[model samples]
Target: MLEMAKIVVQKTGEQIPVMYNPTELSLNKTVVLLGQGSNIQFQRVEDDDLTVSLFFDTYEQQIDVRTKTDKIAALTQPTVGTADRREPPVVVFTWAGPLFTGMISKLDQKFTMFLRSGIPVRAELSVTFKRVLTPEEDQHDQGKFNCRQLWLVRENDRLYMIAQKTLGSPDQWRLIAQTNGIYNVLDFPTREDVGRTLVIIDTHGETFNEVGNV
Candidate 1:
């Protein structure tokens, strides 16, 4: 009555189904400290990561180790030329519905149970993915230009880290500082500024109506 989970490689446009669905899936959310005190701050959703463990067997399923290895390797391989700075191919993990869309962040494989000829008959693969939010999706919530979000400073909380967690990329930290009128880099939020608030301006550089304190 349920469909098995499958990983689709967009570059090759090939879908590889696992022999057995993973028993568990792990998801993580990012949280920042509001100050040196006991208070904790909740930020916007960061990139969503997914991990899937798969088992490959040749003795029982007629699928050889090489076949499985090649399939997994293809998922991790770079799709574009070296001269191009674009990232590797995007991977989609789907089951009954689309689960995640992103690139493979890590892949671990192990081979065990070899035949007398030294051929591996059984193998295992552990894959992890980092979610990439598209522009449309990034601005989807109340529209980026009109959405207002605030984050409280924490001990050792840097603009870059905050940007990475909130904007999905650390490179956007300058925009955060600029939007908040933080001209002096030395005045950047530190433990002393823990109770201070910083405005999260989206990529469009538009100012939204400010919400209450965090």
Candidate 2:
């Protein structure tokens, strides 16, 4: 099998850059625009000549829906058993596949990943690399890389799941956040803020003492 590791995405302008300067670039931070749409560029390094396959998680069908009058439909309602309205599966990434033809390179490979409604587009994940060779007993045939896990990117979060997945632990969140220059996680749940919290409470006895003094 092919030995694979976590894939890291460093953000860039939407237009793919023909070349990158490793010195000025941020290694783990990704930039998202504030407007309606954000452009993202991905940079990853992989062993040469390995085939990569893409898998999309299928969404579970919705079994319960409310009517316009606020009435809940019965479980036996015909719509419940009917074939679900198949939403077009958004294509997240399209590239050369080991589904047959092989061979990939170090240069920037371009592709697009699309998001569809009802799907959680943002997520945290653990990537486990595996090698699958086509020939049953061919020792020389190296394997391919598959997505080992897909997870959610919670709200009020900064780092993507890719960091944790790659590192095999959630503690890696700070490394990702610090690399991005986000000092306060309260504002954004980047690494610096993942487990940081503050709380306050008043003592009833202290309140009585103050009132009596007044």
Candidate 3:
């Protein structure tokens, strides 16, 4: 059987499964032009954007389709007391494998069907996601060649759990914390840590394991 496409919240391990898989996807990127005509060159690439249409149907269940699309819309809202930053939660869109890891940049919802009481029974959602890269990666053009395997932090990740996954031992969490300079060793993977890149390097600067980027 074929699997359904879904958006996973990197903060709370919540899985928002779409009613149907996407039939098509659109990807785009921007390039910067530098220098004069002869010396003109592609300066840098920015904003890897992914767009997909999701469909939600609650007709058989006799429920409002907004109940599903609202979850996707919430991802574009800022967290409490963070109005100044306007940073929404990051999410990963996955189907059979990882597709993209980014925050929801644009969301457009259209209700196509309704019940007798005017309750929406079907909705079409157009979601656009902007790819996020680590600061180290963003400065690659500045002679920064330091690249290593990194684990993309996901929802509900604990220090011990990460150590076990990467280093093959739960007791190595302290070593990981020390290597990463994390003071809060006990409560790791804070909300701020989610959707971030994590490197599993030992004190000797040897990598253990990490997931590949999409």
Highest lDDT, which number?
Answer: 3
Report the error of model 1 at residue 4, Å: 1.5
- lDDT (CA) per prediction: 0.73, 0.27, 0.77
Q: Which candidate would rank higher by lDDT, 1 or 2?
A: 1
Model 3: lDDT of residue 193: 80
The best candidate by TM-score is 3
After superposition, which runs of candidate 3 have C-alpha atoms over 4 Å from their true positions? 80-86, 141-214
Superposition-based RMSD of candidate 3 using all C-alpha atoms, in angstroms: 16.6
Summarize candidate 1's per-residue lDDT along 1-214 as a digit string, tens digits.
Answer: 7688888876677888887788877767553335566665433446558888888788765446867666767767666546656566787898887888888889988998787778788888888898877777665532445666699888788887998888777767777777777766566775556788888865564322232211
Descending-TM-score candidate ranking: 3, 1, 2
Tens digits of per-residue lDDT for model 2, 2-54: 32221221121111111111112111323332335465432322222332332
Clashes of 2: 8
Which regions of candidate 1 fall more than 4 Å away from where they truly are? 31-43, 61-63, 140-146, 149-203, 206-214
In lDDT terms, how accurate is model 2? 0.27
Model 2: clashing residue pairs?
Answer: 1-131, 2-131, 92-113, 123-153, 124-152, 124-161, 126-165, 132-143
